[model samples]
Target: MQQLLLQMLDGTVTSLKVFVLTLIFSLPLGFIVAKGRMSRNFLLRGIVNLYIQIMRGTPLILQLIFVYFAPYYVIGFSYDRFTAVIVAFVLNYSAYFAEIYRSGLQSIEKGQYEACKVLGFSKTHTFFFIILPQVVKRILPSLGNEVVTLVKDTALAQTIGVSELFRVAQNAASRMFSTMPIFVAGVFYFIMNYIVSKMFDFFEKKLSYYR
Candidate 1:
């Protein structure tokens, strides 16, 4: 049991690494995608919209497989499995986040833009100072949902043969011929998601002053 716990701890570290890195990359990339989707340039908007459609419309496992294998097939080069998993995760989640951001940005009334314009605020200043705060408040719930989903989705790295927690549990289960390892893995996932939920709750309360 101690051995199993140790193995699981190692696996959890991998899972957490994937989760954290995905969030770190995807959050900023999502904002960039959102901006592109909302751009005044029709071609840029169209391209970004198409990318979002492909990402959101497809199964993430498929994306993972493609990301992992495409370089070898298309470019005759290989990527580390973990790197591919991170790439797949970031690309897939960014699309969802982009839509979330787009909705939040669109929710702000045009009058707010006008108000900022009349105050001699530059577009950059208006966005960073005036627009973004309200968008964050409005999108908090949806963003939390996506973040929670990301916790579970990290398990999908197993599909690409990255030894995340679920894969570790499966390996142990197969060797032991018992379901206990799977149950233990479930506990890990539940605890992680619980922490994520509480963190989001804290932020929601902190930002409630916006109301």
Candidate 2:
């Protein structure tokens, strides 16, 4: 029983690691991709859109397998399971976030940009000062959804031997020949997602003045 508790704790830590790593990497990459998709350069925009489509179209489990194992099979290099999980997750979620950012940016009125230009603001200044807040406000709900999904998606990391929550639960269930640990894992996920939803709700309300 004590061993089960320890394993569960370890699994929870791993899940948290994956979640944090994915968010850290994906958020900035998503912004870059969103900008690329919005670029006036035809080639850049096409390339960004193509990348987003491929990531979004595929299953994350497949992507995790490819990231974690295919490298060794193809090129004789192996990555740690945690690293592979983080990379796959960041890439997959970044694509979705890129679309969210694109939608938010597009929702802004063109007149705002023109006004910024007329005020003699540089592109960078205009984007940072004038456009970013509105884009962030618009995308907060979508971002919250992605965060909630990420809580569940972390379970996919177990397929690559990362020993996250679901994997730990599976081991526990097999040992006990019961499903209690599985239910416990579900509770962990539910609580994590609930906390994320509340945090986002608070932020959304704080940003309501922008509405």
- Model 1 residue runs over 4 Å out of place are none
Please report, in order, the local distance difference test score of every candidate based on alpha carbons: 0.96, 0.91
lDDT tens digits, residue span 14-67, model 2: 999999999999999998999899999999999988988889898999999988
Q: List the residue pairs that clash in candidate 1.
A: none
Best by TM-score: 1
Candidate 2 regions exceeding 4 Å error are: none
Q: How well is each residue in 75-106 modelled by candidate 1, as lDDT tens digits?
A: 89997999999999999999999999999999
In candidate 2, which residue pairs get closer than 3 Å at backbone N, Cα or C atoms, i.e. clash?
Answer: none
